[model samples]
Target: MASFEVKGGNKLNGTIVPQGAKNEALQIISAVLLTAEEVTVSNIPDILDVNLLIELLEDMGVKVSRPSRDTCIFKADAVDADYLASEAFRNKGGKLRGSVMVAGPMLARFKKAFIPKPGGDKIGRRRLDTHIIGFEKLGAQFDYHDEEGFFQLSSPRLKGTFMLLDEPSVTGTANIVMAATLAEGTTTIYNAACEPYVQQLCKMLNSMGARISGIGSNLLTIEGVTALGGTSHRMLPDMIEVGSFIGMAAMTQSEITIKGAGVEHLGVIPDKFRQLGIQLEIRGDDIYIPAQEKYEITTFLDGSVLTVYDHPWPGFTPDLLSIMLVVATQAVGSVLIHQKMFESRLFFVDKLLDMGAQIILCDPHRATVIGLGRKHKLRGITMSSPDIRAGQALLIAALSAEGTSIIQNIEQIDRGYQYIDERLRQLGAEIRRL
Candidate 1:
């Protein structure tokens, strides 16, 4: 229920550090329940979703301690299994989609897991068939309570096997991997999600004695261990935030440096922005973007209109397409944005169109943006953020527009970014939270 009042036309400067990866934190934090020993996680983002997950763990009697603002130690020596069946978990877990991940580790350890209908962005239909089917493949019995709207999963002892996933669902892969870690035999997963987040989770689990191979590929092999021990892990920097900063600097004509951006792990993000004709200098582990009056989009050799689309890992991420679409509005040439993963993500173009950007919404999943090319400045207008990435896109547009813009429903942005308005203000942006 908060709003951001943004005064446009500010050229931001200075260095900003990317926060810890939010997606990675969700998977790793939930894995902490797999061990009774003290597991310490560093570089944890202080965002609403992460904090809510931590609070849920604490409610189940997991001993939680924070040594620093971005570090936490979890010891799940005495968790209350009965509480899993309570209505509190249903109400709380239903608020965040990441909450569903706890099921795998819980079932792996306690022989039972329950999760309410998880909630998240309405971008498209994100089905849980991958996670549930993977669990069932590994010897877990699944049941649904129609009245309660919660899934109940139980397994006396999980027995590992071979299976091929329908798709490389990231959360689904993490859940299955965690569950198979303590299963009785060997597990081979084909078409598994091999994103950096999933790789880090596997590495972290291996450090605690889980035997997993094929860390960076779509196929993974796991040999279930009797138990996992304590381990310390540091999360990678948020690459999506790094991409957002790149778009922000280009749109606002700012000279900014993003420090410790973990550039090595940012697969396809930099090149995708470069395709939009933005210049980026890589200095050590930092990304430096200089002010530009105009940047032209690149097309194919035959002069076909450039198209930027998203795919699975090692491909352009769908999360950054919103920022990419907004940045394209200010570029010198035209580009078609195809958000193949989420059907409803492109609907946010209506808000951008109201800001004087020339865009054609082709369908539920695609749009064609004709960049104004700095020919005229965009006029700000009131808008509401429908999701996390779109919220950041609106903020970027407001920073580059000609007048003040008021954005409501900022809670979606807060779920991912940490103190976004305050951090932007430090970088010379004229933004205030109300």
Candidate 2:
């Protein structure tokens, strides 16, 4: 139950580097279990969820070596498949949603995978039906025990085949792709999630001798191979963090530069911020957001209200919608913030409204933010974080508020961002973690 005592009203001014992609690191690190050879990955975000998953891997007897702060080499030659069924895994693996991804590699290499019900942010119902059905289509059998809350999967030499996912679940696509890579035949996946995270996973798998085509598209083709070897891969810059910084800069009237942002991999993210009338300059690989008194929300061409919503890749990511909603509170005009992916994420607007922001909570999935238009500054208040993305949005709001704010349950924030308070301190933000 750690809390943050934030003294707001100070504009940040400095250069900060975005951490490695947390979502991508989860999928990429889980793929290490697919082969016995050494696989090295760099640019891993030092976060709680990732460390928990790594500990889960080590508990299953994978040799993990950390040569640097952001580098890890995994040797799964002695992986303990039996450990997946043990009580230790049931207790520990259930803590992280990323732990579910280990099922893909475990089933591919050991022909068996077991997991208790996974735990993560309670933003919405994150179902595993996509992952389960995908595996069943690839010659695997699935069984679940409702009373015990565990899923069991086994395959006697999986043979790849064509499958269409009901939704482009990011984790589902990663799981099926990893399983299909070592199967006996070819696999074609339609309606797959093609986020930069998934695309990077496909590239990393290909570097390890898995033949996968269509790197950045919803349809992926994979040719099975007998085995995969070791390869080194680096994670892309966290687009969520990049978008969060963009929102923070505009909300707090700060001049900040994000270093090593991987601009090309971030599709539609910068443009979406620009739609909020935030001016961003792309200087090489970095993104520079200049201080502004007030940014205006752009109206549609027909002079209608601006709408910001999430979609699959090539559209704005859902992870940043919370941040965008907070930024809209200070913008010069009204805008609609629609979080289509998660039903309850928009409920945090109640906290923002308590802080003096004008917002109408239309429903579980939508919020209409009427910007104070810089006519009134948001006052700080005590709040608790509900989820990772919402926690970050609150942090940004607190930083831009008129007085001190205390945020409890910051462990939710630590689950994703790496040393967030320390990083924000480098940018002259007044945030203290307790």
Please identify model 2 stretches exceeding 4 Å from their true place: none
lDDT of each: 0.95, 0.94
Per residue, candidate 1 scores C-alpha lDDT tens digits across 1-434 of: 89999999999999999999999999999999999999999999999999999999999999999989799999999999778789998889889999998999999999999978878787888889999999999999999998999999999999999999999999999999999999999999999999999999999999999999999999999999999999999999998999999999999999999999999999999999999999999999999999998889999899999999998899888999999999999999999999998888988888888899999999998899999998888888999999999999999999999999999999999999999999999999999998
Consecutive 10-residue window with the lowest summed lDDT within model 2? 141-150
How accurate locally is residue 367 in candidate 2, as Cα lDDT from 0 to 100?
91
Locate the minimum summed-lDDT window of 10 residues in model 1.
115-124
